[model samples]
Target: MWIVLSLFTALCEAIKDGLCKKGLQGNNFLVIAWAWKAFSLPFLLPLSFITPVPEYLSLRFLGILALGGGLNILATILYIRAIQASDLSLTLPLLSFTPIFLLFTSPLMVGDKPEPTGFLGVFLIFLGSYILGSSKPGFWGPIKGLFSEKGPRLMLCVALIWSIAANVDKMGIRETSPFFWAFCVQAFIASGLTLLLFKQQKSISLGSRKNIFLLSLIGLFTAMGLISQMSAVNIGLVPYVIAIKRLSIVFGVIIGALVFKEKDLKLRLCGAMIMLAGVFLMTA
Candidate 1:
């Protein structure tokens, strides 16, 4: 069930990225980022009221939430910037490195350790990432190209930040229901982003009607994806859930190829398959 939920999260995440990329066509990236969280308020806020509250809210829980939300906001900003700056194909695959970072973060943040097989899964994911980035001249050529580009580097940072945030999320969920945690964290992020947006742009206008509509769609998918992800993490191991969720990279690559006509489809798809195999190993 958790696996199914995580898969749903992946689909919603991929769709959200596509929609966000579309919204970025005409709107400011910050506006799109702010809308990504703010618009989701309508869908997520209500969950706080109906979901069972935690028996007690510890200072520890609040602390984790604050820390996690801060990290998440930073990650969101970097992720939006990375996507806005680079092609979907180049940027999205680097996100596969998140689970690799999690091998270290999960243990330290949540006291969760991967099974022996999981380490092998992580190795496969690493190899797949190398394949995805590698091309032409030689094995090292693609790697050099990857570092030479800004998008992949920004995405790599996003992946590392997300690994920490994911463990913090698991910690928060252990103390409260997934829906409740999602509501609080998202509300915090939205509030912070709103302030940031207002600071940058005098007012928080939705701009043209088409952008409003596009942002609204992005928000809906974002809400669904986050809600599903929080639920899955609450019940499953963070690493396992994240590994599965990384399937979003595959979906993102395919969407990029079809919708955006991104280059290097064959290489990207091959990398995605290798990563998918790693995800399977982690699950097994």
Candidate 2:
């Protein structure tokens, strides 16, 4: 069940990315980022009222939510700037490091670790993702640039933050229901971004009917992805769940090929095959 939910979450994430790509033309980064959270409120806010609340809330839960939301906002901003700062081929490959970071953070923060086979699966997923993004400069160049370059360095920080944030999410979900926690975290993030936008004198106006509609779609998928992800993390191992979630990269490649007629399909397809093999090892 967790595996299925994780795949659904990956699908939702891939679709949201594609939609955001389409919507990114006229919109500023901050506004689109805000829309990713704000527009999801229509779907997410309702879940708060409908879902059963936890019997006992604790200070730890409140702290986890606050810390997780803050970390995520920072990660999101760094993520956006990383892409803007450097080439996609370089920065994106660094995202695979998240699972590796999780290997340490998981046991420390959440007191959980994957089996040896599952750990190997995580490593393979990282390798496959690196290959998927290693188009122009090849493997060594990107690997070498991980620290010296600004974008890769920023993305590495984002990965490290996400690794810790994942554990925080697991702790928060343990204290509250997944639905409620999802709503709370997202609401916090949306509110935080709203303030940041205001500080920058940026308006949240989506502008243009088509752009608005596209972002709405992004929001819808974002909500679905959030719910499914939190639910999966609640019951599944955090490292394994995150490893599966990175399947979004494979899905993104397929979507780009079929929908947008993007090139470089063969190389990425090979990488996807490697990722599937790793997932099999972990799930089997």
Q: What CA RMSD would you report for each candidate?
A: 2.6, 1.3
What TM-score quantifies how close candidate 1 is to the native fold?
0.89
TM agreement with the true structure for every prediction: 0.89, 0.96
Pairs in clash, predicted candidate 1: none
The residue-level lDDT of candidate 2 at 144 comes to: 81
What stretches of model 1 exceed 4 Å from their correct place? 81-91, 129-152
Instruction: Give every collision pair in model 2.
Output: none
Candidate 1 lDDT tens digits, 131-227: 6655333445434536777877888899899999999988888888899999889988998898888888889777778878888898899899999
What does the lDDT read for residue 154 in candidate 1? Answer: 87
User: Per-residue alpha-carbon lDDT of model 2 for 73-115, expressed as tens digits?
Assistant: 9998998899888887899889888989998999998888799
In angstroms, how far off is 140's CA in candidate 2?
A: 2.0
